[model samples]
Target: MSEVTERRAAGSPADQRLPLLQLLLVGFQHVLLMYGGAVAVPLIVGQAAGLSRDEIAFLINADLLVAGIATVVQSLGIGPVGIRMPVMMGASFAAVGSMVAMAGMPGVGIDGIFGATIAAGFFGMLIAPFMSRIVRFFPPLVTGTVITSIGMCLFPVAINWAGGGKGAAHFGALEYLFLSSLVLAAILLVNRFLKGFWTNVSVLIGMLLGYIVASAMGMVDLSGMDARPLFEVVTPLHFGAPSFHLAPVLSMCLVVLIIFVESTGMFLALGKITGDEICPKRLRRGLLCDATASFFAGFMNTFTHSSFAQNIGLVQMTGVRSRFVTVAAGGFLILLSLLPKAAYVVASIPPAVLGGAGIAMFGMVAASGIRILHEVDIVDRRNQLLVAVSIGMGMVPVVRPDFFAALPAWMEPITHSGIAMTAIWAVLLNLLFNILGERGRDALCGHH
Candidate 1:
C-alpha cells in the first residue's frame, strides 16, 4: 500500500491528541464553521410561525443545546448510537421548507412541526438498521454527484451572506463584498504559508481578521450584545406539547428519508477520506445517531437533526480526522447553548465574514466530490451522463428556487431541496443505466 493509504488505514491523524488549549481552539473553530447552518432551521421556522423575537431567540438557543448534545453523542457514541467519527450533528436543511409550511398551517403552527419531527425521528430510528441494505446503490458516481449538487445548492446562501444577507437594507453593498473578499483572501494566504495546526485553523483566522477590519470601519454594531442574558436553560416543550397531525408527520417522515440518504453518502465519503471500512453495521450506527438526535431535538424544542456536511468538508480540508476534535466542539456548543451571552458573541460575527469562510469550506465539499469522481470510470458514457444530468437537476433549485412554486405544497420538501432532488435522480439513474442493466444482461445471457 502507498504510505498515505497505509497511514489512513492504520489510523487517521484525528486519533492523535494536541494540547488542551489547542484542542479547544481547534474544536471551537469547527463549531464556528457550522454555527450558521446549525441555527438557520430555527430562524426559518420561527419566522414562519410569526413568533416574537424572544421566542425566536429561544428557538436558536434550543437548537444550539440539542445540536451540542447530538454532536457529542455522535462523536463519543452511546450504546448503539454514534458512528464514532468526526461527525458534527445539526438541524437538517432538508426539513426547513416542510417545517415552515407546517408552521403556517391552521392550528398546527410550531407544535405540529415538532410533533411531526418527533414522529419522524422514531420512524428513522426504526428504519435505520435497514439503511445499509441500500448502500450498494451508491457507487462513487452516485455519491459524488449528490455531494457536488449539495455544494452547488448552498452557493446561493453564501452569496446572500456576502451580499449582506437576503433582506439587508444595503444588500449587495460594496462594503460587504470587500469584507468577504478580504476574509477569503486571508484564509487562502494562511493555508498556503502556514504549517501544522495553524494551517488547519485558517478559516477561523480569516474570519477573525475580517471581524477586526469590520470593527475598525465601524461597520459592526456591538450594542445588541449588551442585551443578551449571561445564562439560560433550554426548557423542554418550550412551544408547548406537540400536537401530532398526519400531514406534518408525513412531511417530516419524508424529510427523515432524505436525511437518511444524505447521511449515508456523508458516512461513505468520510469512510473513504479517513481510510476506514464502511460496512453495513457501521452505517447503521451513524444513521441511528441521526435519528436519535432528531428524536431528542423534538423534546428539546428543536427541529430534526442530521450530520452536517459542512463539517465533513472541514475535516477533509484540515486533514484533521480526529473524532475528539468534534467531541471538544460539542463541549463548546453545549457551553454556548447554555450561555446565551457567548452564543450571541459568536452569532454577532458579520455575515460577510462568514461568507468569506463559507466560500472556501463549501467549495471544498464540491472538490471532495470531484476527488471521489476520479475513482469512477468517467470515460464511460453512462457515468458521464449520470454526473452531468444529476448536477444539472440539482442546480435547478439553487438557480431558481421558485421553479417548483407552482407545485403542490406537499411537494415542498422534495422539490425545494437541491440535495434531495439530486440524490433521487442520481440513484435511480445509476440503477437504471448501470446496476439493473447489468443484471438484465446477465439474465439474458444465462437464458441463452
Candidate 2:
C-alpha cells in the first residue's frame, strides 16, 4: 500500500514499468513462482533434524513468515538492510548442509547451534559492507559464468519436480501433470484473456483452482487445518534455544558470506534487467537487509535468506519491476506464517505441480544467464572455458553428492553446495583468466 514514486528508468520494459494492476499480478505471480522453494528448506531441514511431521509443518510455516518479512526488507529496505529493488527473498539452499550439520533434535540437543545461527546471521550483516567489494568484480566473465552456473546448478531441482518427485510411489503420475498443467494453464490463460488485476492475480487464481481440483479429486490433506489453532503466533526461539558451537557457527558464517556472494550476482542481474540504480551503495544496503532477514530467520529457527531465484523469471515474464508488488507478497507471507491453517493448505500442493513450475522458472533463469553471455566475447575461448568449468564445478555435487564425501567434515559445508562452489570457482577463474585484478574493477559486470 506504500506509494512508490512513479519514476521510471529508460530502457525499463513495459511490464517492468507497468501500472499498479499489472504489477500486482506480476508480484503474485512471483509468490507462486517461489512458494515451493521457500517452504522446502524447512521441510528438508526439519526432517534431517528429526522433527516429526507436525513439527516440520510448523517449521515450514515459520520459514515462510520470516522469508516474507525478509523479502520486504530486500525490496523496500531500510538504512542498509534492503536492496530496495524488486527482489524476492527465500531460504538459501546454501545453508542446507550447514543446517543439517547442526542437526538440532527435539530434546537433549545442541542448543549452541541455534544460538550460533542467530549470532552468525547478525555477524554476516555486519560484514556486508566488505562484501560489497564483490560487485566490482562481476564483469562479463565472472558475472556471466556465475549467473549461468546458477541456472545450471538449479536445473536439477526442476527435473526432479518433473519426475513426480524423488521416491514417489509412481513416477510421472497423471495427477501431477494435470495439476501442473492446470496452474501453468491458469497463468497462460489469464495473460491471454485478462488485463491488469485479474491478469496479475492469475497465478494465485491458478493455484487456487488447482488446489480445488486437486482437493475435489482427493489430492489434498486438510487434516492439519482441523487440528490447527485459530491463530498461531510465531514466538522467538519457538524451537530449541540458540546453540553457539564454534564449529557449527563458523560453518554457518561461511554459508552466510557465500550467500552474499551469490546474492551479489543475482541483485546485479535484477538491477540490470529492471533498470534499477542498484549501484555499489544500494547493493550494500540491499545485502545488509538480506543478511538481517537471514539473521532473523535463524533467530526464528530457519535457514539463510536470499532473493528467490525463481522470481527473476517472474519479473522477466511480467515486466513489473516495481518492488511494491514484492512488498505485497511479503505481507501475504507474513500472514501465512501467522495462520497455521493457511500454511497447511499451501503445504498440500503436489510435488509434480511444483516440479512443472520449477522447470519453467529455473529454465528462464538459465536462459537469462546465457543471454548475458551473448554480450561476452565467446570467441575468446577463455570465456567459453570459463562457462564450461564453472558450470561443471557447480554440477559436481548434483552429479555426485558423494564426490567430496571422503574429504574432512569441515569441507562438507562448501562441497555440498553446487552454487557456492560454482560461484567461488567462477570468480576466481574469471579473475585469473579474464582480467588483471584491479581495485575499482567492473570487468565482470553483468551485460547491461
Candidate 3:
C-alpha cells in the first residue's frame, strides 16, 4: 500500500479494528445507507426503456451484482485500481440524463446506453491520471457549489417518491403522505435519542418500522409479485449486444467527465474526514477503480458506476472508517445479488418508505457541501458571486425542467443534470474570477 501522509493515527477510529460481529453489523449499516441510491439508476433506466416488470427486476439484480463487485474492488485494493479507502461504489445518478436520452432515441435503447457507458468508461480511465492533476481546480468554492447542486437536483426525485411516485393513480394520496411522515419521524426520533451504532442505523430502523406499519395499513402488498428463482447467475449482454452510436457515446462521455469532477470533491472530502492527504497517485487509482467498474458494469448489464457520496456521510456519522467494513458490505451485496428472491424483497420496499430516508440522506449531502463552504471567505465579493451564480445556474433544471426545451436535443444531457451544470459553471467562474485574475493569482503566490 502506498504510504499516505496525514492519514489517521494508528489507534484512530479509522484504523481501529473491531470484533467480527461489530464489523458485520456496521457494514450492513453502510449498505443500508446507500441501498436506495444504488438501486435507483437501474430502475429509472429500465423503466425509461419500456422494459417489462420482469426485465426491470432482472436489471435490479444485475445492478446489485455489479455494484457488489465494484464496492469490493474499491474498498479492497486490487493491483492499480482500488483506493483502499472506506468508499462504496454504485451506479451514478449523473448518467441518468444521458442514458434516458439514449433510451428514448430511435433505433437506440438499453443496448445503446450500455454501449455508451462502456466507451465512456474507457475514456475516463485513459484520462484518470490527467484528471487527478487538476485537483486544485476544485477549491472549496467550486466543490461546495457542485455538491450542493447535486443534492438539490436529487431533492425533486425524493419529493416525487414521497407523493407516491411519478404517474401513480393515487399520487399525493393522504395515505402516502402519512406513511412518509411516519417514517421520517421515526428516523429523526431514533437519531435524536440513540447513541453510537443505533444512531448510525437510524435509517434502517425507520424503514423497518415504516414497512410494518404500511403492511398493517394494507399499503404493502406482494400478492401480484412475480416469483423469482432462489438462486440465479448474472449473465453478460443479457439484453443483447450493445449498439454503438456517436451522439449517445459523446453525451455519456461528457457525463463521465462530470462524474470525475464530482468524485474529486468526494475523495478530497473523505481525505479530510480521515485526515489523509489526497495525492495525485491515490486520486488516479481511485478514479481508475470508478472507470474500470463502469466498464465492467456494461458487460454485467448495468449502467455507469461511481463512488456513492452518501456513504461519506455514513463514515462521518459512525466514526468507523475501516475499509474492511465496506468490504463486508460488498460481500453482503454479492450474497443478495445471487439470491434473486432476497433482492426482490429489498426491491419491494415502497418508494414512499424510501422517501423518508431519502430526504435525510440527500439532505446530509447538501449539508456537507455547506460545511465545506463555511471554511471559505464568504465576505469576498468574487467568492460570493461565484457561489451565488453557480448555484443559480445549477437550480435551473430543478426549478424549471423545460427552461431549455427550445434548445436542440443534444443540449438535454447537460441541461437535464443540475450537478453537471453546476460543476461546469463553478469551475469556469472560479477560473475567471479567482485563479486567472491578478489579485487572486497574487494571493495564491503570497504576494499580498
Top candidate when judged by lDDT against the true structure: 1
- Per-residue alpha-carbon lDDT of candidate 1 for residues 223-328, written as tens digits (9 for 90 to 100): 7666778889999998889889998999889889888988887887787667676677778889999998898789889999999887877788777778888999
lDDT (tens digit, per residue) of candidate 2 on 180-228: 7777787678879988667556556766777678778887767647988
* Per-model lDDT: 0.83, 0.72, 0.79
What are the per-model numbers of colliding residue pairs?
Answer: 2, 22, 0
In candidate 3, the residue pairs with backbone N, CA or C atoms under 3 Å apart (3 or more residues apart, or in different chains) clash, namely none
Put the candidates in lDDT order, highest first: 1, 3, 2
Output the worst ten-in-a-row residue range by lDDT, candidate 2.
1-10
Each candidate structure's TM-score, on Cα atoms with residue i matched to residue i, is 0.93, 0.87, 0.89
Q: Tell how far residue 40 is off in model 2, in angstroms.
A: 2.3
- Model 1 ranges off by over 4 Å: 1-9, 439-448
Q: Report the C-alpha displacement of residue 81, candidate 2, in angstroms.
A: 1.7
